[model samples]
Target: MKKIVILFILFYSAVFAQSKFPVDSSYTVKSVYDKVKKAHPYISYVPARNYKTVKEEKEIVYKKIKDRELHLDAYFNQTKKRNPAIVIVHGGGWRSGNKSQMETFAIEMASKEYSCFNIEFRLSLEAPYPAGIFDVKNAIQYIKKNARKFNVDTTKIAVLGCSSGAQMASLIGTTNGKIAFEEPNSDKKFSSKVNAIVNIDGTLAFKHPESIEGTVAGLWLGGSYAEVPQIWEQAAPLNQTDKNTPPILFINSSVPRFHAGRDDMIAILNKYGIYNEVHTIENSPHSFWFLNPWFDETIVYTTQFLDKIFK
Candidate 1:
């Protein structure tokens, strides 16, 4: 009778575990960290600055999809002279995140004489892969088209993003003039090419054999590397490096997962004679951009990079 009771208990436990997070689902289950984050979303981390001269224009519509209106927030000092611009893309593993998450960074950049556009894009939940690429490209084109209105120097623009956003920014910087990635109704007259790229610990390549099967990359790309090899290659910035690729700055954590393919990417860029630099923050978490001290250091590295590239 005890053996039969034990068997019944084991069966019930198995069923409960399967129901909690199904093993055969197309999407991977969210990590414990992701779950905790969803319950308590992170707040913005803006440092104390003496400069209070920044101005902002919030929720400027950039694209319309059916009834959905995508928008960007612009920040700049009200200067007569046009300033160089940076477009900030927030990261949430391609499934979550919004433009406002990067507002503090934008405000800081604005105070430093750089026009900043913090943009919103489709996540993997709404659409996957090329959808994000197209949205970011469209945002850049929009900014370029309306540069005069924003008092931006159209020629001096950079792309900066964290995590998945960083990956997308890298793609924009490397794949300029790649017609296949351009959106259908985008402003073709103005180019989406950026002068520099700042990658904040995003993945650079996705073709390795030991790559995980159902994490954020798998879900965002819509399949495992084995199932969608071409898409994986197409989405990787490492595979898209070329001569025309602009200078890149990498602000990264010491985590191996976040810095995957960093060496390979640098090697490819070096081979093509492209300028790039990597700054790894020791003893910091992957999401250090959202935390203190690290946040300040991030901005310092970022501004230095922009100053050099814009010069």
Candidate 2:
């Protein structure tokens, strides 16, 4: 009876979320516009600044299914030295947010001679938890296979994500050798291993005892912990951490609740002698990466971390 109840709840949630997050331009699921609207008085836009962008290639399809396609935008600098790369994921509670949310990061990083790809995956309203996870992992695999074309140094690839996207980044970095999270593609020999992770305000664990993920998370995660225990456990980076997990850099907002399981994961990383850094942007609101001043600080921390690990 309990198993039957769980399946019913999961099925119903998936059906309902699809309706709520229907694919439309107005839904802004794939737009650069901020969705965390007016949650704070300071939650306003800052102009995106970048260096002399000699080249930017947009709408490059990484994954496709019939008419539906997942695209990534790549930013590049003029350099013969195979550039270090980043696969960026944006966050909007896993139900909203588009790839373009991270365009500023890509443009800025590219100017610094790093190749960055901004990606959009299936949101909870479109699919569910692991779907988004596999999309990112597969995107990494795609990047590795197409390294030469993108002028990327596959050995120095990193996954950078913001908000819930950060949670997904942590999970992807930890589960490097695992096949369960893979979404198989034409590149059978390609590996999705990332050398480092840049997690911006994404919690390490969703099934933590104190987790208050709420409905937005549930919409992406499929069901509550009671309904889908395994999915919740599998999605948490803290649970998947092993010696193979890459070094991680966490940039968090001032919110305490968002730092769920961070210290515990750091302990695990330390035990394995895996390098990690934590930078809390003091007095900053959540989604500060999309804002100014704090966003610049984040870049400094991220570049230093990535340089330490990859350079």
Q: Estimate each model's TM-score.
A: 0.83, 0.86
TM-score of 1: 0.83
Q: What local lDDT does model 2 show for residue 219? A: 75
Give Cα-based local distance difference scores for all models: 0.81, 0.82
Tens-digit per-residue lDDT, 1-311, candidate 2: 99999999999998776553475233332233254444545555657676775368899898986667888888887777788898998887887778876787788888877889998799877798788888888788888888887789999999999888899988999998787877755366888889999999998888675567877777788898788888888889999998999889999988876879999999999999999899999888777787666768988998888888878
Off by over 4 Å in 2: 1-21, 24-44, 184-186
User: Which candidate number maximizes lDDT?
Assistant: 2
Query: What residue runs in model 1 are displaced by over 4 Å at the alpha carbon?
Result: 1-51, 209-213
The 10 consecutive residues of candidate 1 with the worst lDDT sum are 20-29
